[model samples]
Target chain A: MNYLLDAFAWIADPAHQAGPNGIWARLGEHLGYSVVGVLLACLVAVPAGLWVGHTGRGRGLAVGLASAARALPTLGLVTLLGLLLGIGLVGPMIAFVALALPSILAGTYAGVEAADRVAVDGARAAGMTEWQVLTRVELPLGMPLLIGGIRSAFLQVVATATLAAYVGAGGLGRFLFLGLRTQDYPQMLAASLLVVGLALVADIAFGLLQRFATPAGLRTTR
Target chain B: MRWIGDNLDVIGGHLVSHLLLAVPPIVASFLLALPVGWLAGRVRWLRAPLLSAAGLLYAIPSLPLFVVLPLVIGTGVRDATNIIVALTLYGLALMVPATADALRSVDPRVVDAADALGYGGVRRFLTVELPVAGPTLLAGLRVVAVSTISLVTVGAVLGVPSLGMLFTDGFQRNIMPSILAGIVLTIALALVVDALLVALGRLVLPWTRPAAAAVVAPTQAEVAP
Candidate 1:
């Protein structure tokens, strides 16, 4: 308890808040990397997943890829990339993007696949083009799952982004590694708390986003 | 390849430690989750809280958990016990919900039939509900097995002497072969374990063998990270 209080006190201290190594700067770096990583993942995964789901040609392959990707250890990947690329933000970013990809891709593919077949048939019967049916109908209906995927991806990236510190990049994990090195248990606890706190906040915010972005009918049916 | 051949004994030792660190937690958590999951499935009030707790546990990042396990468990920083206990907690977090869902997925008609045939609650659960739920339970186990295998490497960061040591040592020495070897071995271990579990599931639940492909499709979605 005292350790926790001391950790909180350390975080509250203005000096820790204002310096180059302060919480704000580190938090910014963490968020920046996570956002970029997730965006890159989304850019690649969503389109690929959507195409695969729409075409129904590679669903099995997509799922297999996601599973294999998920099984790769993030820490190992980060270090491996760091070794190859010579330790910088790029290594961790690449790792984070890889980590984020599977969930989003799975979600997009599953969501689209789970869309109402009847509605899709109806859209086609009404003479909408394949692309039109996908973009306007399937994507809209699949929004909930897509958002779910994004939410999972966001949480994963943020949590795993702490590994940035391990690869000589700056993030909340600095406090964790630094605390471990210096035997500053309080700092370690504080950083862990920050990571957990950030994850929870992102989860809640995305939950709301999922609720809002999902169509009214779909929400009630689900 | 030469480096791997040379370090075969060392890598084998690490693999043993990794299995030691991983397998017990998975087995223990599965055993523990059985009763909790049964309770959650049977009792409406317990389900939400139980699943919520599991979700919270699952959400915790692995690195922080590994670092903090010693403080939480009163173990030495370098103790493998810390990793074991931490992984057990994680295993429980994953398995609890899976167990609950598996039990819930059992067809209610079979339960009703068992009850109608005058079997008591315990007998019905053991003979009917459990057998019916076995396939889904096995599916859940497959996810847990793969997940636990992957996560065991994370403990290497804290010096728990798993194959992850390869990563740490490789990074320190800038040795790509060792790092690649570790990654390959770790992933291969996961795949092998997953395959074994799938085969075991087939052997135990012959009725489910035909639908094994269908059963595995949704298992990927349940993978939380």
Candidate 2:
């Protein structure tokens, strides 16, 4: 109870809210890395996943790889990468990208696979090129799921970004680290609250994006 | 034969410590998560916010949390203290989504049917909604347990005595065998925790098997075909 009060006090303090201590700057830097990581995952995973889903031959391999990716403990992966990259955001960044890929890949696969079969046949009957059929029909239908994958990857990257702080990548985790070292409960609470708050705000925004992407029928059903 | 005698104590100690570190946090997180999740489900506006909150909580980096926690509660692991708090935060991710989705996914028709049958709101939720939602909720618990097992390694990195400590100790001392031992033991611990959760699911919620295992497990037909 007392600890909670102290935490609130620290968050409320005018001094702590200033300049570098501004919540957005700390969270913004963290989000920047997360965006980069997810963008990189999407760049590769989306196209590869799209092709795999379109043909259905390489899907087994794709799914296998995604599961293998999940099987890896993120910390273990990061530590292993750390050995090669040297302790910094780079190692953690690679691990985060790896973490984001499986979801994006899977989501993209499902999205494209779920495209209406008739539409594709109709496009073929109309003499559309394979690429045209995909671009005009498959990718459009796949957008919601693809966006879902992006959202999932983004949330994951955001959460995992905290881990980067371990190897000296700066973020809200610094306050968390400091609180632990100094036994400053208020500071720790404040930092944790901030991180959680940041994540919640991001998720709500993502949910809105999902709703927007959702087809009208589904939105009403939901 | 020589290796057995030389490392028996170290191996045994780590085994006990690892279980001690991992189990309580998972159990505590479940206890904290259930009611909160149920409450969030009852209120329509609350669901997204609650889930988002949980997701964010789950995203927290464990190492920083470990370092920051000592300042908040004045350190040292008590059954009611620092470790449980950390574990609770970690579990929040799995718990919130699992619980919320379970509740949300309860077929809307079922809830409507209960209302038509003259069941009160609370009764409808408890008798009708909760049962159908059982499998999904359990699935969430299972995810939390596995993730918690992995995240517990953060404790060792922070100088907490556990299997993670063994890993850290072995790493620092450059003792290859011990590091290998820690990795093996931690994997064993995670696997065991996961297996136990699966067993619990089968026992408590039989229908949950389809929802949980189907995604992660290969169908027999897929394999045999």
- Which has the greatest DockQ? 1
* Cα lDDT tens digits for candidate 1, A3-24: 7688899899998888789999
Chain A, model 1: TM: 0.97
* Candidate 1 residue-wise lDDT, B21-118, digit = tens: 88898788888889998998889999989987887777777777766666667776568887777777878887888889888988888888888899
lDDT of 2 by residue, A1-222 (tens): 676688788888877766775655777777788889998998999998889878887888888776444334454554455545765778778878888998899889888898889888999999999899888788877778888788777777766676556545667766766776787757767777777666667766776787777766445654
Where does candidate 1 clash, by residue pair? none
* DockQ category of candidate 1: acceptable
Candidate 2 wrong stretches, greater than 4 Å: A1-29, A58-71, A116-128, A170-175, A178-194, A215-221, B1-12, B25-80, B89-138, B170-184, B200-225
Each prediction's Cα lDDT score? 0.84, 0.71
Which candidate tops TM-score?
1
Which regions in candidate 1 have their CA more than 4 angstroms from the true location?
Answer: B211-225
Give TM-scores of chain A for all candidates: 0.97, 0.89
Task: Say what the interface RMSD of candidate 1 is.
Answer: 1.5
Every candidate's DockQ is 0.47, 0.18
